[model samples]
Target: MRKMARHKDVSPEHLPYRRCVGVVLLNAENLVFVGSRTEGPEHTDSARPWQMPQGGIDDGEEPYPAALRELYEETNVRSVELLAEARDWFTYDLPPELVGHAWKGKYRGQTQKWFALRFTGTDSEIDIHHPAGGAHPPEFKAWRWERLERLPELIVPFKRAVYHRVVQEFAHLVG
Candidate 1:
């Protein structure tokens, strides 16, 4: 069984979940895109600190467009074909330490709508630095292609369960 982080604080229960979108971007070689997040105010204690592209949805934004916008915002890649979407939204709680720090204490965690997208462009089109003309500082400092099944281990422990479910949901579509 998966051991998930237990939130011991009662206050977090009263906080709502942040609505977000997660992208599993696959290249033609069947590898998934994983980014090494930069150390920041919202940084977790994960040793690897790697994750797929993800971000919160704007007000009145639909999930599909939100997913695309996040992917482009984080990866600077716009040439992608929609492959699949998770059957249901998945949620993960912030560790107790992060409950009040991350996302400005706006939510307990995130409720994400996951999408699997196929990269339709060449590697030259991928750029993490200066994403959105550096309008948004890069979330990731470095990135690489990785196996889909390895994501759970590569991500922050608190979010591993969601990553596992996403891999299970989209594994068949990749090599």
Candidate 2:
């Protein structure tokens, strides 16, 4: 453990990526779920702050369950069925400005397991105003269903590459 701690403090590049799960919720209309972030005061100049539902992977939790839990926690929408899973996990790095500030400075970025889900319920089921599935407040201030191809353009810049990969990997399922 001492050796690991020493390596951990070595440098930012040596820091591990946070384990996470990301989901793309698709409706019959083939639209992807997107939510506008409730940005902090410091992010007033952020350009694209929208993102899909996502969250950390709790210890002992598998990616699929984590994905479902995160989706519900962030959106309060449970009427979904797994449509597909990505062939591989995707990762993204936080910019230098965010590296030691995100996740309470525990991680350099995130290594994510991505899932695609199909919504089986009505729009009224989504309650972004007050998420019932989580102990905390909703992560999103507003929500919308958007074109799958536009995902790469909707998220924060650092996350765009992963979105592009997801869009490409799940292209066949979208339409």
TM-score for all predictions? 0.92, 0.89
User: What are the per-residue Cα lDDT tens digits for candidate 1 across 1-175?
Assistant: 2243334444798999999999999999889999999976446654868999999999999999999999888888999999999999999998877776677767889999999999999988888998865677899989999999999999888899999999999989875
Note each model's CA RMSD in angstroms.
4.3, 5.7
lDDT of 1: 0.88
Candidate 1: worst-modelled 10 consecutive residues by lDDT: 1-10
When summed lDDT is taken over every stretch of 10 residues in candidate 2, the lowest stretch is 1-10
lDDT by candidate, in order shown: 0.88, 0.82
Name the runs in model 2 displaced over 4 angstroms: 1-10, 40-45
Q: How many residue pairs clash in each candidate?
A: 0, 0
lDDT of 2: 0.82
